[model samples]
Target: MIYLDNAATTRTAPEVVEAMLPYFTEQYGNPSAIYSLGSAGKKAINEARRTIAAAIGAKPEEIYFTAGGTEADNWALKAAAECCAGKGRHIITTKIEHHAVLHACGYLEKNGYEVTYLDVDRDGILDPESLKEAIRPDTVLISVMFANNEIGTIQPIREIGAIARERGILFHTDAVQAFGQVPIDVEEMHIDMLSASAHKLNGPKGTGMLYIRSGLKIRSFIHGGAQEKGVRAGTENVPGIVGFAAAVRRALSRMEEKAGRERELRDYLIRRIEGEIPYCRLNGHREKRLPGNVNISFRFIEGESLLIMLDMRGVCASSGSACTSGSLDPSHVLLAIGLEHEEAHGSLRMTLSEENTQEELDEVVGHLAEIVQRLRDMSPLYEDFMKSRRDRT
Candidate 1:
């Protein structure tokens, strides 16, 4: 099968699985216990923390483990708002963020904190100047995604971070899609809070981390028996943590080579699809997007039908984010970029990984072209447009 949905999640690497086996069996003791086995678990967690921290140029003590990116996002937005409420009750974010951040912002809105949903350009690039103009005296925190999950648009995070830092506002970024795939230095970026998940980078699911910039007065996220130094609670997933570190180390080692290969194929895939498919538009910035992401919209064809047909043809792709795939509504990301509902409904996101071969990409594009053509042939929207053109001619 040709699998091209790495933006949703990646296959767990074999080395990551191997690194987790010992933790799941021999060192399965509770980390809070004083026994040797338990101490081993605790030590492994610390080591994993250090590995993740070093990957982002953050200190180990500031990294707090959580269930995944969703939980981390929820913690970052909610806790930061509460902690900084005395100073202000306002937050700033963008419309193209994953639902984890969007929903968290919504919840904050219902609780009386004001949130500004900043806009992006047609290519899904947010202007730092717009963010700068939106800031007010009451704005306490700024949250922006490191990279767009659906369109693969990389944001101007450094510029945005600098703007927030200059104003003394707490800056948070949801880096779930960019954490291991791209180079990230939290210190250099001036990222006060950041969220990442292991599953996005070929590690086990159910593991993630939040970096809180070595104390800026954020409150406890979860209240229970003092886990995560009382910042978060509940027993740790030792095996998951070990696997996460292994994946990070492996990704770091192969990042340059893997990224170059993926980027080459990504451009190839985009070129083939756009060159072959008619009435198609590429989503996101061509030069500033992720290395292995290709999102396109085929006019007059429904994205769902195209995806289903591609699946039948042994290609696995997605219309949008996995979380919102069930919803019939067009993608929020697409809409934020000024796509009409029909165009948004026609959008398809095909993300790749190091495991994806160029041959597989070739297969996917062939299948996609056929599927889009087949769907458009049966669409009345296509018929009407063609009839109008013929009459005009």
Candidate 2:
């Protein structure tokens, strides 16, 4: 199959698997134990922490392990809100955020805190001026995603961070989609907290990290053990952690080359789709988007029907975030970027990887064009519109 859904998750790298094997069997000891094997486990875990921390320009002590990006997002948003209650009960985030942040904010609203959902422009970019205007005396935290999962729009995080820093409000970014694929420096960007998942970068699932800047106190998310410096309580997934570090190191080593290749392919697919397909628009900022993302809204067809057709043709793709695949609702990201309900319902997201080639994209595009035409041919909307055009002419 030609896999084009890297944004949903990646196939774990063989190198990462090789690096994790020893930890699973030979070094399988609890880091909290007092034995030599336990000490070794602790050392490995610490090394993984340092590796991830250094990647984001954070200190080792500031890195906390979580189950995945969702947990990290919850910890950052909810814990920060509770911890900074004295400072304020108001939080600011964009309408295009992953549902993890949006749902957490909903919970906070029910609990008496205020959350301002900011809007993005037509290209799915959050304006810093809107953020500034939304801030109030009661605002204590600002959470914006580093990159949109659906549209792949990279936000102006540095500008937003600077604004939050000037106002003394904590800034957090959900970097799950941007962590290994893009360059990010927690210090340089003035980000107080950041969330990333290992699986997004070819590492093992069930392993992720939250970089909370030093001296930033948030409440413990999981309550049982004293692991993670008493902030996150659970036995560390030593093997997965090791694999995560290995993946991060491997990706950082060749990020520039990999990104260039993926960017080339991304643009090629975008150009092919827009040039060849009728009544379809590319989603997000064309030049300011992710290096390996292609989101398009095809008119006169349903996204689900197109996805099924693509799947039958041996190409794996998604219409929007995988998390909401079963919801039957139009994508919030697309809607937030000003797409109408029908447009949002007919979107397709095709994310790539360095492993993909131009040949694969060519096949996907060819298959996609035929599939779209087939589906649209069966669509009453397409027939009606064509009839209207003929009548007018």
Candidate 3:
């Protein structure tokens, strides 16, 4: 199959698997134990933490390991809310955030916090000026994603972070999709907290990290032992952490090369599809999107139908996020970008990885164009839309 859903999750690299194998069997002792094996596991976790921290320009101690990006996001938003509660109970975020951020914010709203959900531009880019205007004296934190998972539009995080910093408010970004693909320096961006998942970067699943800037008084999400600087509890997922670090090292080593190739291929695919298919438009910014992201909306065809057709043709893509796969509702991100409900339902998001080949992408796009045409032929909505267009003319 030509897999193109890297934004949902990536295949764990062989090197990452090899790095994790020893930890699963040989060094299986808990990191909290005092035995030699435990010490070895502890050492591995520390080294992994240091590696990941250095990648993002953070100190090792400031990086806290979590189950995955969702957990990291939960911890960051909740902790920030609680920590800044005394100052103000208001938080700011974009409406296009991943469900992890949205749901966490919803929970906060139900409790006591007032959250301001900012709207993104037509291309799915958030406005820094809007964020500035939304900031009140009671605003404690601003959570904007680094890159949107559905549309792949990269936000102006540095500008937003600068705004938050100037106002003495904490800034957090959900970097699950942007972590390994882009260069991230927490200090340089003035980010107070950032969340990333390993699986999105060709690492093991169930492993992620939250970067909390030094001296941030945040509360713990999980409670038990003194793990993760006594902030995140439970024994570390030593093997997963080790594999995540290995993947980070590998992805960052060839970051430029891989990103360049993916961007070229993504553009090729987008050009091919738009050229071959009628009533199709690209979603996300033309140049500011993720290197491997290609989200497009077919005017009348259902995204689910197109996804199934692609799968049948040995291509793996997605309608939107895998997290919200079963939901029948149109994508919130698409709607936020001014798409009608029908347009949102007809969107397909294809995200590539370094492993995908240009030849495979070409084949997939060819198949996709044919599939979209086939589905449109069977869709009465397409007929009605064309009829209306002819009538208007």
TM-scores for the candidates: 0.99, 0.99, 0.98
For all candidates in order, the CA lDDT equals 0.92, 0.94, 0.93
Cα lDDT tens digits, model 2, 254-337, are: 999999999999999998998999999999999898899999999988999999988988999999898999989999999888
Highest-lDDT candidate = 2
How many pairs collide in each candidate, listed in order?
Answer: 0, 0, 0
Arrange candidates by lDDT, highest first: which order?
2, 3, 1
Q: 55-143, model 3: which lDDT tens digit per residue?
A: 99999988999999999999999999998899999999999999999999999999999999999999999988888889998999999
Look at candidate 2 and give me any clashing residue pairs. Answer: none
* Candidate 1 similarity to native, TM-score: 0.99
TM-score of 2: 0.99
**Which regions of candidate 3 are displaced past 4 Å?**
389-393
Across 182-233, the per-residue lDDT of candidate 1 in tens digits comes to 9999988989999999999999999999999985877888888788988898
> What are the RMSD figures for all models against the true structure?
0.8, 0.7, 1.0
Please list all clashing residue pairs in model 3, or write none if there are none: none
